[model samples]
Target: MIIQGFYNIIDKTLALQFAAPDAMKDPFYVDAYNALNHFTGSQIVTEIPLKEMQSYINIATQYASQTYNLQWAFSVMMGMGAAMNFSMAYGRRNITKMKELSGNGFTSTILFSCITAFGVFCIVYPGWNAVFITSQMGSHYNVITEHLCWTYTIPLLAAAPLMFLSYFFMSMLRSEGKMLWVVLMIVSSLLVNCGAGIFFMHVCHLQLSGAMMGTVFAWLVQIIWGLIIVFGVKGSYLKFGWKDMLFLKWQNIVAFMKAGLPNFINNAALVITSFALTTLVVQLPNQSYNNGISILQELYSSITPWMTIVLSAGIGLTQGARSIIAYNYGAKKYNRIWQVLKRVSILIIIWFTLMLVVFICFGGLMMQAFAFPKEYVPQYRWWIVINFMTYPCCAFTYIALTLFQGINKSMLGTFTSSLRTFLVILPLIGIGYAVSMATGNPIYFFVFIGLNDLISSCIIVPILVHYWFKYRQKLVDLPDDFRSTSINEETFKDSLEHLSKTEVTAAKEQTTPPTKKQS
Candidate 1:
């Protein structure tokens, strides 16, 4: 859903930069290919709202050993920031503030991304098509065709502004729970894109460009749909014109940048940490290894899609919950944030736990499905089984980070993620390696991945406790311009008013003994 094979083409090329020429499909290439876009893919939008977490009873008692997770959960951080901030402003009835945040978030992301994409086309292309980064074994970038390079790069580059702009608009609808229309538009665009992209990739032989154009056109659909609704619908209070969207607002940009820069840093740090972690796997053969290490690399590549599904589903729950939390946080209902957090965390945990158990328990079935060697089953099983330990931890930490940002503790959110990747996770590998060496267990490497999450959770628990204590009774500062809208109240108020009032009154009347009817 993010980038197509055109973007992934770089993943393969990055390996060419690092790996020996003869080794095309070996572990180095495999790891490097997978990790390339991951390390350098520019996420960290920081336009977000967030969620608190739930009961922290012993994780061992909870999930025992199994786990689950998401791919671009953090990417949502950007949209969440904007959506939440907009919601907050709306809750306070500050249309100016809401529009300011939305305008800046949307404008900054689109303008900056498009500019950066073009710059990348200029800088990155010549290195591939003309100039080359040489190895001692000669240039690696030379292998790519100028035609193929231009095909994927151009459309993707051109698609940047549209993609990000669509995302910014979608975030508003997403936060407002504008599901049916948004979903309809999305489904339609996606169907068309799939059909068109297929035609381009196959019939037209446009390859990556077709795929990217399909994406660009899909965004066009969203752009049209979003504009109609944002302008046509009056209540959202998110209206903007060319001046609002295109014209630069230094103040809003400064505000967003101040709030959002940390997320960018956190994102970059996580990628760097992940790449460093992958390098450990790449370097493992040098340590004392066998075919097991290479097998691990292949295993990582094979199950990546499945892993992404697990991650996507787990975070998808949070995405739904994010709006509730964001709106509440904006309305100054802090306790509701806690309540929403608990409920969402439980749902996510249960869902991910089920996913992990099913995947692990059906390990052989999964391997068979992927047509992996039956002998690969044990390591594959071990990979999911061991890393599954982190599912709850990862979910908890992500929710916490998001919520922290939602409540405008953006710095804390950044720190939480940065610490998880750079500080907690990387350091634990030595122990994992030592255990693996001493006990001759290759699976311990994966164990450290989960262990890092668990330890990071431990590190962040106190932070949450402190924040809860400090901001528990916090309320949004309602000024003259601020008015509590039906939208804001409907979420928290109407649940009791619309759904529970009749039942509660009936229960009270029935339990009151009817006063004997004065008889």
Candidate 2:
């Protein structure tokens, strides 16, 4: 996850470098381009002017990226259901149930991917066009609309299904304990994305279209690799065949929907909140200050993913542990869940604390590496400090939410995740925007952004503590047989074999014709 995070940062930096103004064509941007080239040392000729590129990239990609993210989140929810169901079935030594769930997951991915692709097309193309036209957003808005319609629409829609499938496959693979393979798949795809993007933009001079093309190509690679592993790999426990694809159970689909609800809410809320923030930033009274604030917000947004690498680590730990927790819970081994939670908590705290220190010490250097204006580095450094002040709080929230998810407590997980975005951050952003306007000071806006997680933590941590106690007591109250610490491998294998025979018998019965009625 850490390596993926660093790659993400590098990818973003490269995208900017490739979009930079051409020094020869625009002598005015020569100095700025030189500065950027000093950092990136790139020889690629870019046509987009620096003044226009930042806002263009930020706004144009915002809807496409977030829309895809929302879709990915939904697919993740489906994937989580598949993973948890498969893990639990494995715990019960029920081979039939495991195969059924895996099949249903694959079927769900196909249906959902098609729907999401269509939805994305509608939303980004016609839906946004209608919005721009009706709002009377003027000539600049028209340019943005044109860019979205012509440049981004096709590639984004094309990639949606491939990306969704790859993500679902990764989730299933993770459940099967193929974490190493999953990591390799992600790294390979990311490398392909960057390399392809560089080739298209530099060698072909296709610019934004080239970048989107790269994304499409990368997802294609990922889905193909995922297919080979899931279907062709020798040791994989979970495999989906054509028969599995043909059997779609409504109950299983509903279960996946229920399982994924919390994560979907979390992702959707984030997209909405981001849209809200962008709206607020663009509406500031002073155009100069507004532009500055926009740049700041963009920089902050770019830095946020890297800063949250620690949070990603926490999430990764939770993901890794979730299968164990789900499996143990299914197997009636309550004690093991607590053990996993304890170790994950300790590691998360240590990781977050260490990263916080690093970010505080070296944030300015990072800012410089991104080619942020030297004069603004001091201000940006302060933003980094303030923004990350609540890392520990965020870490705790993740632990709490993941625990809820692991145990299949979607409501509790949804509530916990929603509190930070809707109950805390959104309100703070609104109030901060109002205050900034009233006081003629933009600092208030950022201050509230920085403080949101800390404030939300006050509510979240207590809930987490309360649930921790409640669940722990519940675990303690389980029967002795249900609380066993060890599994009997022989008994487990016997049960699996028995279940497999039962499934075959059931299948034969379903396929056989009924006897003729007696005269």
Candidate 3:
């Protein structure tokens, strides 16, 4: 996950580089200019002013990044189906069910990706002007639309299906306890993406379109690599075949959707919140803030992907722990679940603490690396400091969400996931927008956004505590025969093996019948 995050950072930096004065030399820009001229049937000037061209590229890149994020959120949503279902099936030792689930999950994801890609394509191509005309960047609408249509939207959407498949394969691999394989897939893809990106953007001068093409190629590589590991590799615990793919069932599809809905909502909420905040930022009434819109947007675009990198650590930990917790929960090893939770909590705390320290100490340098003016570094540093003030609360939310996912409490997970975004930060955004309007100062908006986690924690922490105690007591009260006394790794493995063997023997006996009854 961290490797993937660094890929995003590098990808964004590369895209931003084309916003320079010399960007007109890029083939992508020239092609877009020609295409727009042909479509509009007017000889638009080739020599657009350098600063104006830079602004167009900068804004286009920011919006393009947002579109990519939205696509990724949907991919994560679809991938969760395989992750949860396959892990649960593994816990129950139902190898057949796991294969069926994986096949059904992949099919459903592909169908959904096709629909989503088409929908987005319609919006970007024919509907771009109508959709964004009312946006806050009133005068720049035409430039934004043209850049997005030619460079980012068309190229990226073309590979949406492959991207979704990549994520689906990743989820299935993760559920099968193939973290090493997953890491390899991600690393290989990132290296190819970076290498391809440089070749396209610098050697071929494809600009942003080249970067999008590189992304598509990366997804394809990841999908092929994952397929090889799953099917070609020997000694894999799960078996998947063509029969599994052909035998689709409505029950299986519904189950996958049910299991994955919470994750979908969780990620979708982030994309929506980001969009809302960006819109609000553009609409701020302060003249000073309005004058600095370019800087503000650029800063936001730079900071968010890196912040996602920080948060992805916690998310990655939760994902790893959730698989173990889900398996144990299916095996009825309640004591082991608590033990895993405790260890995860400790690790999350350590990780977030180190991150907080890093953000505080080097926030200015981080902004400087993005080429921000020295005079503005102090303000950017404050943004990081205030935004991350409640960073510790994220640990609790992640643990709670993980616990909910592991135990199959999708509604609880959905609610908890939405709490920070919909219930807390969104309302705060509205209030902050109003406050900024009244005071003619946009700092209030940042402060309100920073308060999101802290305020949500007031609700999330209690719910998490209550459930922790409830589950702990439930474990203590379980019957002796059904409960395991020890929480060691060996005991857990032995219990699972014993149960699996017993189940196999029972199945054989049922199928064999009683031949001796004839005597």
Q: After superposition, how far is residue 276 of candidate 1 from its true place, in Å?
A: 3.2
Winning candidate number (TM-score):
3
What is the TM-score of candidate 2?
0.80
lDDT of 2 by residue, 87-204 (tens): 7776766665677788878888778888877765665565356442212222224343245434544666676677667767777778778888888887888888888878876787
Error of 3 at 374 (Å): 4.1
lDDT per residue as tens, model 1, 1-519: 222212222222222222112223334333443343243435422211110000000110011001100111222344555676676666565655666676667767766665555555554354553221111002212122222334444665556667666666777777666766667767777666666666665566554456556666777888888888877986766776566667766866655554454455555555454444443453443333212223443344345445545655654565556666767766767667788778877776676668767776775665444324456575467676776666667766666755775667767777886666577776777677667667766677778777777788888878878877887666333334343443343465766686687998888887875456664
The C-alpha lDDT values of all candidates are 0.53, 0.66, 0.72
lDDT of 1 at 256: 57
Model 3: how far residue 415 lies from native, Å: 0.5
Poorly placed runs, candidate 2 (over 4 Å): 3-11, 19-55, 62-64, 126-153, 285-293, 307-310, 368-371, 473-519
Error of 3 at 108 (Å): 1.5
Deviation (Å) of 55 in candidate 2: 5.9
Weakest ten-residue segment in model 1 by summed lDDT: 51-60
Among all windows of 10 consecutive residues in model 3, the one with the lowest summed lDDT is 477-486
Ranking by TM-score: 3, 2, 1
lDDT tens per residue, model 3, 1-519: 666667566766666565343466545565555564463446655554444455455556656665677777778877876788788777766656777777777778888888887766655553455342225344334443355435656677888889899988877788788999999999899888888887787778677787777778888999998878877897564456777787788888777777777777777787778778766777666433322244665566557766878877887888878888887777677888888888998998788878878889988887655545467776668887787777877777777788898889988988887887677889998998899999988778888888888888788889988886776676632323332432434668888999999999999988985778753
With a 3 Å backbone cut-off (N, CA, C), the pairs that clash in candidate 3 are none
